[model samples]
Target: MSSSRVRKEVDEALYAFVDRQRPGLLGISEDLSPMLSALDVLLAGGKRLRPAFCYWGWRALGGADGPEIIAAAASLELLQASALIHDDVMDGSDTRRGQPSVHRRFEALHASEGWPGSAVPFGMGAAILLGDLTLAWSGEMFDTSGLPGEVLAPGRPLYDVMRTEVMCGQYLDMLEQARGTGDVESALRVVKYKSAKYTIERPLHLGAAMAGASAADLEALSDYGLPLGAAFQLRDDVLGVFGDPAETGKPAGDDLREGKRTVLIALAQERATPAQREVLRRRLGDPGLDLSGVEELRTILVETGALSGCESMIDEFAAQAHVALAAAPIAAEAVAALTDLTVAATARRV
Candidate 1:
């Protein structure tokens, strides 16, 4: 079956597991209702991209369907959801997917029921702790997957590396925000450290290793995944400015509002005229900047050909990823699926 079809099956299974698991949460003793409610919100909506990537990696490494592998993959998806919830809180985001962000929701919950503590920080800290719990739960799920003891062992180290990589990526992102991430080289390095590897490459490696792929095969997958992940993030950079709120699930131009120094922004500065560059330098990090200014800046981006240039770069990375896949010694079917996923992920509406 195609990956989409496979995803449908897995989606149904995951939700069912989550539903069953929900009741047993926090045990019968204390009032775990709030935590469970928060968890439900976390799991309520998502693209499940991480698990799908893991699944594809396994498929590439010649894995066949079994309950244990599916459960392990599902655990990864849940962990991603947990991460996003905490990430949103850390960013102090007001909205997510066009709805209240995790901290906001928690704060509102606290207010509505008259719970104590400073709502903002309390909510954020709680969400962070909850996210930690989710990661822990994922580890537990993997341990209980019932796979042959041997099949699970080799994958553990790779899985451990993935967690560390994402945390490091988050830390790098925080650093970039604090003190500007410098030139094109530095910008690209941030892209690689903050997103490319952990989001796609390492997860692919983890899943493939789980299926017992050889070293050569794993290296080939990384070549494909690294570039594809970079392209995926580049597309996200474009969308954060140009995409519609209805589709992208964000207030338009959020990165600009946040003063995020993306590759696109860097490229725009590099190409802009002196007057245009001054406009950017003045308003790039100004939190009070308005939508009209954002639109005008976007206009400058178009006039200077920065948007098109960034688009070309995104295409280049995606193309390289495809080329790497073609050179890899994987089954034709798995390659096709990964190709489809690559396009879907980068050029996606959401």
Candidate 2:
């Protein structure tokens, strides 16, 4: 299958899950509407990336995507939705996909309705609870995924490791922002922990487990997935700087404003002249910077070769991933699908 075809199939699977899944959780006076709304928000707008990765990984290892596999994939997506919600809160991001984030939307509603108390905190609190629900339900979905319980029991340990890595990665990300990047190695550490294991490795493992894919196949996926996931985040780091606000739906220079210690930034700091470094140091994290300033910084990044340097790294990781995929016990069609997906996904125009 082609990447576009894979995307369509994944969308169908996800929507089928959503169509029958409860739109509202039931409980007397339990505010089921809000919880349902949160769930809808999660399911409504998505690229279905993680779920598709899981599904495809299973398919690649010669297993069919049965109900158990599909449900487990959806559960992984729920986990991603949960992470994203909390991430937006932590980043204080206002927009997602060209619209207000859930908290901001809720806060706007509270203001329009003249609701009592501080609507900002109230909305954030609600979003937090929703995120929590998503997280818990994700685990529940995993438990009830209908795969042979024995096969799945071993996989939970991998999922648990993934979760711990993400939390630790998130914490490390915050610390880097606060404490400043001491060196390139420190920044890469953040990328490995924050984006690699959870985003790709665990999803691959989950899929393989659900399908009863062999241990050798599972190892092959890890080899492919780990590098590919790291590459994914690296591409994202590039886009954070160079992407059009219109296309990315993130404000231009959002990562700069956040002072995220991305590999891109590390390269710039290492390669740029003192004056260029000074400009980055001064303006990189300033949220109040205007468009022209952002553009100027973009120029500096290009001139410093950081942009191209990051692109090279993405290519390297992706190439390594392809090598691993070629070595796996997957069908040619599935390998082609994954290959196409990786190329299109990693080389996304900013």
Candidate 3:
């Protein structure tokens, strides 16, 4: 199926699944209505890349196109939503997709109600519960996706591993930030588990496993997916530093403010001069960072060759992904769709 069609089907599946939960939630208490509202907003904005990867992975292994598979793939969106909502809370971000982040939205709601001892705590608590709810629901969605138990059983290990890897990756990310080491190796490690596997590799594995793919076929998919996933995240790091706010949805240099120890930043830290390093230490992670500070950091990233180095890495990884894709023993149509996705995932625009 085409990407657009996949998106539409996934969206339909997701909405239908979430709608089924509404009556139960409202029955418990109407106060839980905002939980659904928050999910609706969060679910609307992603690229739906994970589901696409999952669907195409199944197709590559000769699984037929059907609502069952689409519903199974759509479950990844809830997983993605769970990650993103919690990530925003962890980063203390104020906005997402050009709107208030879930925590901030709840915080605002608390403030508007004038019935809270402290709005921040209420917001944080609500957001955390919502995130937990989505995390649990992701599993529920996948299990009840209408795929036969026999088909679904084989993929369960992969699904469970993917979840474990992402959470560990998230912890590693937090550890990196806390360490503030700016080491390229450590940063790349974070990229692998937190993003590369979760974003691409394991999703492919889950789908392929469901289709009863051979071990060789699974290896081939990994060869293609791992490099592409890395490149995808490197591109994201670049965009975080220099992308237009209109395109990225967050303010310019939001990553810098978040103190993300991205490979790009690590590279800059390695190459920077004494004064430049000092400037980086001072400006980066300052939540009140202004446009001028952002510009300064951008200049530092550029002059230190970190930006160019990151771009080179992106090109190299993408090339490796293409070469692997060429050798992958999969359907021709899957190859074409995955090729298009590689571009979409790593494109300059968000």
Candidate 4:
């Protein structure tokens, strides 16, 4: 099946599942409606990249296309949603995919409804529950996706590892922010487990496992996925700092505002003069940062060569991914699609 068709199927599956939850949710309280609705909205966006990777992985290993596969693949989207909602809360971000983030939406609802407590706590609490609930549902969705026991069972281990790795990666990310990125290697470690492994590599592993792939096939997919995934994240790091809000669905310099200890920032810190380092230490992570402060930080990043260095890293990883793809022992047709996916992933505008 074409990717567009798979995307459509995934969307339909997601909405259908959400609709089924309405009666149960409304029974708890009419007030719960907004949270579920907001989830649907949040899930509606995104590149559907995880599901695409999963589907292609299955296809590469000679699995046939069908609704069962699409539904199974769509489960990854819910996992992605869980990760994102929690990530936004952790970062205290106000927006995601150009919409008020789940927490922000709940926070707004709290204020607008004249809820008694502070909106911040209420919103954060609600968003956390929403993420937890979504995480559970993703597992449920995958288990009930109608793949036979043998086909689904093998993939379960990869799914389990993917979940654990992501949570651990999230903790590493939070720890870095608390301690600050002392070096590029530490920052890149966070990127590896958090974005690279969770985002691409394991999704591929899961799909390939479902198809009962050989050890060599799994190795090849990993070889292709890991570098591409890293490049994909480096591109995201670049976008977080310099991308247009309209294109990135984030405020310009949002990463600077959040004080994320990205590899890009770590490089800038390494290369910065004492005076420039002073500006970074003071302004980065300050919630009250203004436009001029953001510009100054951007300037430091450019002058110190951090921006170009990150771009070079991306190019290098992309090249490595291409070499891996060239050597992969997958079907001839799959190579073409996987190569395109590598490019789209690292070259995405949003």
Candidate 5:
């Protein structure tokens, strides 16, 4: 099936699953209406890439196309949603997907209603609960995806490990921020655990495992997925700095304002002149930074060759992914779909 068709199926499965949960929550209390509404808004957008990877991974192993597999793949979306919601809270970001973040939405609701106590705490608490709820729902969706028990057993361990690794990666990311250093090695580590694996490798592994793929097949998928995942993140890092807000759904140079210790920043710091370094140290992480400050940092990133270096890295990683994919013993149709997906994911504007 085409990637677009896969996306449509995944969306149907997700909507059906979530709709099934609504009455149960409403049964407890209709006050929970906003929680469902927030999730609806969040789910309405996204490239649906993870689930695409999962579905393709299953197809690579000759798993037949079915609603069960689509539902299973769709579960990954909830996990991704949980991560994004909590990530925005951690970063104190004002918007996501061109809308107020879940916490901010709740915060605004509290203010508009003139609720007692501070709105900030209430917003944070509500968002946290929502995130946790989504995390739990991810697991529930996977387990109840209508796959038989024996068929689902093999992927369970991979699903558990994926969850654990992502959480650890998230903490490592926070620690990197706290340490306030921009070493290339540390930043790469954060990328590997926090994004590359969660976004690609594990989803592929989960799907392949469910399809009864062998150890060697799993290894080959890893070789293909890991580099592609890294390139995906590197592309994201570039977009965070240079992409148009209309395309990216976030402000330009937002990463700089957030002081994200991305590989681009690390490379620039490594090669910066003293005067340029001073400008970086002063303006980076300044939440109040303006357009001029952003332009200044953009110039430094270019002049230091950091942008070029990042582009080169993305190309190298993509080449590696292509080579791995060519050698894998995947079905011909799946091979073609995955190749297309690789480009769509890395070369995306949003």
Candidate 6:
């Protein structure tokens, strides 16, 4: 099947699973409908890249293309949803995928209805529960994906590790922000654990293991996956600062306002002159940062060569990913598809 077809299958499976839970959720409390509604909207967005990686990884090991695999891949979408929801809450972001964030939606609902408690707390509470719900459902989806216990057994450890490491990485991310880490090494470390492994390497490993891939094949996928994942996040960081609001869904320079200490920002800070550093420190995380302030920060980022440096790093990682893919023992078709996916993933506006 084509990648689009696989994506469609995953979408259908996800909607079906969510629809099945709607009644039970409503029975518990009609107010819970908004949470699920926001989830439905959130799920409709995103590139479904993780599932695509998972599907292609399974294909690399010569696993047959089947509904079971699609269902299994769809579980990753739930995990992504959970992560994004929580990440937005942590960042104090107001929007996601160009819509009000889960929390903001609930917050608005609270305000509109003149609810008893503070809207801020209510929104945060609802969003937290919504994220928790998605996290719980992700495991359920995987367990019931129709992959036999014997098939899932091998990949189970990696699955557990992916979950555990992502939470650890998230805490690390929060800590880095709290500590104001602007060094390139610390920023890269956060990227590796928070995004690189969880978002790419482990998902590939999970699918490959499900296919009973050999150690050699698994290692090859990691070699391909790790650098590629870093490159993917680097691209995201660039877009976060410079991408169009229409395409990125968030306001322009949203990452800056949120004070995301990404690799791009760290590089700029590292190379900045004293005056430039002073500007960065004062204006980067300001919630009320205006467009002119954003322009100034962008100028500093460009003038300091951080933008070019990050672009160079992206090129290096993409090249490394290709080299690893070429050396892998996977089928020719799988390699070809992965090659295309590499470009689509790293080069896209979204």
Tell me the whole-model lDDT of each prediction, alpha carbons only. Answer: 0.78, 0.78, 0.93, 0.88, 0.92, 0.90
- Would you give me the overall lDDT of model 3? 0.93
Estimated TM-score per prediction? 0.92, 0.91, 0.99, 0.96, 0.98, 0.98
Cα lDDT tens digits for candidate 4, 13-97: 8777778778999999998888888897898789888888888888888888788888888899999999999999988899999
Off by over 4 Å in 1: 26-30, 348-350
For residues 182-294, write the lDDT of model 1, one tens digit per residue.
45566777788667876788777777888898889889988999999889888988888888878777787777877777888888878889999888888777767689988
Compared to the true structure, candidate 4 yields what TM-score?
A: 0.96
What is candidate 3's TM-score against the reference? 0.99
**Which window of ten consecutive residues has the lowest lDDT sum in model 1?**
25-34
Clashing pairs in 5: none
lDDT of 6 at 67: 85
lDDT, model 3, position 211: 91
For every candidate in turn, the CA RMSD to the true structure comes to: 2.1, 2.3, 0.9, 1.5, 1.0, 1.2
Better of 4 and 6 by lDDT: 6
Query: Distance (Å) between predicted and true CA of 230, model 3?
Result: 0.4
What count of clashes does model 6 give?
0
lDDT (tens digit, per residue) of candidate 5 on 194-258: 88899998999899999999999999999999999999999999999999898777988788899
RMSD (Cα, Å) of model 5: 1.0
Candidate 4 stretches with Cα past 4 Å from truth are 348-350
Best by lDDT: 3
Q: How many clashes (backbone N, Cα, C below 3 Å) per candidate?
A: 0, 0, 0, 0, 0, 0
Model 5 alpha-carbon drift over 4 Å, by segment? 348-350
Q: After superposition, how far is residue 331 of candidate 2 from its true place, in Å?
A: 2.9
